[model samples]
Target chain A: MKLAYAIPAAGIAALTSAYASAETITIATVNNNDMVIMQELSDRFEEEHPDIELDWVVLEENVLRQRVTNDIATEGGQFDVMTIGTYEAPMWGERGWLEPLDDLPEDYQVDDLIKPVRDGLSHDGVLQALPFYAESSMMYYRTDLFEEHGIEMPDQPTWSEVRDWAEQLHDPDNDLAGICLRGKPGWGENMAFVSTLVNTFGGRWFDEDWNPELNSEEWQTAIEFYVELLGEYGPPGASSNGFNENQALFSSGKCAMWVDATSAAGRIYNPDESSVADDLGFAPAPVAETPKGSHWLWSWALAIPATSESKEAAKTFITWATSQEYVELVGEEEGWTSVPPGTRESTYANEKYQEAAPFADFVLNAIREADPTDSTLEPNPYLGVQFVGIPEFQSIGTQVGQQIAAALTGDRSVEDALNAVQRSVERDMERAGYLD
Target chain B: MSAVQTKRPWVGVLAWVIALIIFFPILWMVLTGFKTEADAIASPSLFFTPTLESYVEVQGRADYPKHAFNSITISLASTLLALLIAIPSAYAMAFLPTKRTKATLLWMLSTKMLPPVGVLMPIYLLSRDLGLLDTRTGLTIVYTMMNLPIVVWMLYTFFKDLPRDILEAGRMDGANTFQEVTLLLLPLSMPGIASTGLLSIILSWNEAFWSLNLTASKAAPLTAYIASFSSPEGLFWAKLSAASTMAIAPILIFGWMTQKQMVRGLTFGAVK
Candidate 1:
């Protein structure tokens, strides 16, 4: 009787201690494809590690940015793990909002990550986040359309050549647009495309002195060229179409060409998702006067917030989700096509992935060729491929994006829009103490 | 009158045309819900291959039932709480007016004019301190506060529209003050209360800004769920349309079921 009672008491104590030690980590992330895959595959991780539980806060990109920024900046302690990106990791890491992940377990192969992506996601010399998916911009076009129309696209086309091709293939009566590009009015929308255009046009967002250069002749020319090309051949309501809209357009066989994130290739080539999956061809992103900044680089990364009470558990989750084992698991379960790509070199080396992904060469080449440290044709005092790295870029870029959209819609002249952008950016720079 | 009557057929045709034009956007959205993203945004006229991929993607991406539960709880709780508070307050102002009653009511109404964003920072800090950032209780409170002025205003108008004779007659019959108001005033003003409550529910259900800003994961409602379908890269029109359809389905069904009550409450004792 005494032994039985002691055994039950000991069992109860163990249960109580287990309950007390249980940690629930809240992860805030954008609703991206890779993150969604991670969320779906997390049950296996949970089964293996019963001590930790995951709570997700999946939001749109802008909302996620706002939520994580506010929480981490204010030390609100709302989220344990945050899904950040190339744009945010270095900035946030420098601000101490993220915990350095340099001490990842040996099997994690911290060195195997693509160097440019790892460098972009690191602060000083410390890796702040592990990449989930990284990408550079590339061109996705309809091979069937090209063949049917007897048009040939070069491996590396110039902007003038692309312009001619767009004009040739544009058939408004047939309901097929020549090109699809992001024109929606947000910093990450039209401005993302426009920034690259500005780069290849031999224009920079700012001079060495941090002076606003929206009204520069090169920028003006680029803006005019963009408005003319999109206005003549782009689809109706193009001003409202962003990356997803453009993707839908391109995938539905409505667009002859699209230049955007290489990550989109997976979805565009997936037969289950896209109608033009088999009819697609890839090329380097089109360039203008300079090929220096023809494409932009980006990575979506998993990070542990400083506000997390369950930092260890959160780190464990991130490590597992972004680990090489997880990539292999995704491949075996969902097929090699669905494995998150561009984060690890070993993934590209895998024969199954290479064979499964037809657009593999374009994606890898784009990722390797993009140089974030030196993206502009003209000298600049900033470090971003598609965006200017400043606290004020969100507001500044948005204002300029609206102007560009307006210009495209014929609501304003390109000159007027550029002038407005110049004035507003100047004022912002002055306020930010960059215009001394 | 004779000339107008002669053109009545044309007028009727014109009326229907106007009505259809007005309803086209909603119809388009509904039609797009059944379309693949490509077909939905495609320029050519209606004939195309329609697919249910968007709906599947939207539903598969989210826990729709949980978001629906939050929507129901917050909207219903806020509506009920607002009604409970507004009834007595509106009654006191309508039947027993003080010198400051008009000023108080106007002042309360004016609070709605202050942009919610202006007060967001302070409220956010307060919510963080109170540990109410993403709880249903917090959402309910905020929703109640947001819809309170409109609720009180509607209730006040309905109460004022009622005749004082009913309450006086009840008092003369030896009923107590609580009984007189509850038994006499409430029953007679049922239409107004019903309409006001229904309107409050609609307002609370559709509110997105506060819910989006204040809540992150736990207390997120259908509006937040719908927003999650939006991608940073580009608009997945089919997915967006599908997400929108699912989000609005509950409210649409609710509105259909409660049409008669809504209409009755909307006009609520206005003529009499």
Candidate 2:
């Protein structure tokens, strides 16, 4: 009887002490380098709080999206903090699935966040997420090859000029593609690039009434031009190439020029990871007939789910991760270029960052100039530069990615591909109650 | 040299070619793991300076032994549980004729055909309700249920192949049902049972979907580990290959060591 009482007393004491000592919050994030750095330096956050613990679940972008979506929808409380993008923050926050991050401490410098990055993470003027790193698309080319061929790259090049340059640089005889672009069939994979191309060509996915306008004249011209350019001058099997594949090709000196996320600047400039690090040059993403949406903005941000039981603790961690102090810590600990970019104006203003990253000013301007709400040349209803800011956009854009691939592979004509996309997207919009 | 002897060398060459075709991807992955990130994407070279950069970085970022330990324990625990439940059911279906036995077996096999995503929500909710999410016990239970149908069918076939005379003799000698199954049927069908257990272990070890969805950090297996190395921002092929190499190394070695038993057991039911 005495032994049994002792066991019960010990169990009660252990449970109470464990419950009071620490509040562990789980964070689900992607495997990008910036997020990895956040995970690495979380120990600092733990040290500061002392009563909080951090657990991480790092997955690829698509996997993490699905996992976090399921958990938040079900109110499973599996993850306290979720690393999302501009694509998710607004839509989910509109549904009240995310906790509004209001009243952050003054030192957090909520005002220092770049406008586009901050606005993209808010729904109706309420900040719903804190950005970790933001990126905009741009053109990366081989300066050596440009000099050798006597080609002049414009400050803000147009598609026609880019086409002529691609033709001039075409050298299949020596295993070089004039240009490489994302051609993989996924919403975030190729659609991200293709949507910006459509925007610069003065195309919009929908009108103000939310009717899909995929078959507009501007879209046809853009798709036809895209098909002709990539089919004639792009790498063989371009349909299988995504951002990573294109990066690999360019860094290995197989592609004369490429266009992709500004975040890739660090990797492609790192001498250890890239062979063309010494010969690289960047330019604003090429425009086509209009320069309105030549570049697209995207960011990986952290937000607390409404289902989180430990909201206060989760807020503490996210605030620390997105603050200037955290940025300085990363700059000092992992070198200056490794600091998360495009989120804070201060990071771009830092001389240390400018000394390390030559493209800092250009990337900052690109991010600032990419206004998601007003990106299209013609007026449109969407709130994203490269995507329609509706949840249904994911499925709709994915199908369009495949349709574009079909055009590039010669399985469908440009007109035919756009027509198919137009019809399917109409059906989706109708079913989603947007058409009514 | 007779005809058989003359054909032996050619057959050996054909076998080698077929094996090489099947093994080429794994071989490429292992080789790429040792290359630098820059060299990895360069046009394939038969020879390059090997480095431990990727392996070192992967280990620094991820805790491999923790995931490996989870994989080992979950696979073994799930396999043992699946076998324990499968054997008696197989014995009952093979020995005692029931009207619904065939239907029951067919129905169990049909469960495997169901798309995992169809029931993912309910299963996740159930696991969460039971406080089993992200626990090794939860994963082990899921793996056991997933492998049960196949394990039962294999053992049933093996038991059917066994001569019923020995079991009848033991029964006549006053051995009870439990005694007869434990002492007689088990010893007789050891090869089939061993193969079923091994196959279950391999399947559970390489399982990705449920493991990824259910476990977050603590109980995640090597699938999650490999996934963390695949960056969306830029190329990290060498590190990804290193993680892939590490994930498959244990299973590859286990399969190789147990090749004889698996080959014998798989071929047993095929012939007299």
Q: What lDDT score goes with residue A275 in model 1?
A: 83
- C-alpha lDDT (0 to 100) for residue A230 of candidate 1: 87
Q: Which residue pairs show collisions in model 1?
A: A243-B233, A243-B234, A244-B234, A244-B235, A245-B235
Instruction: Report how far off residue A42 is in candidate 1 (Å).
Output: 1.8
lDDT of 1 by residue, A173-222 (tens): 98789888889999888888899999999999998999989999999999
Model 2 CAPRI quality = acceptable
The 10-residue segment of model 2 chain A with minimum total lDDT is: A1-10
Cα lDDT listed for each candidate = 0.85, 0.90
User: Using DockQ as the measure, which candidate wins?
Assistant: 2
- Residue B108 local lDDT, model 2: 95
Judged by DockQ cut-offs, the docking class of candidate 1 is incorrect
Q: Per-residue lDDT for B31 in model 1?
A: 78
Q: Summarize candidate 2's per-residue lDDT along A1-436 as a digit string, tens digits.
A: 2432443355345434534558889889999888878888887788888899887788988999999988887777788899999999999999999999988998899999999999999999999999999999999999999999998887888888888999999899998999999899998989999999999999988999999999999999988888898899999999889998898888888898898999999989998878899999999999988888889999999999998899999998999999999999999999998999999999988999999999998899999999998999778887889888998988999999999999989998989999999999999999999998
* Model 1: per-residue Cα lDDT at residue A326: 95
lDDT of 1: 0.85
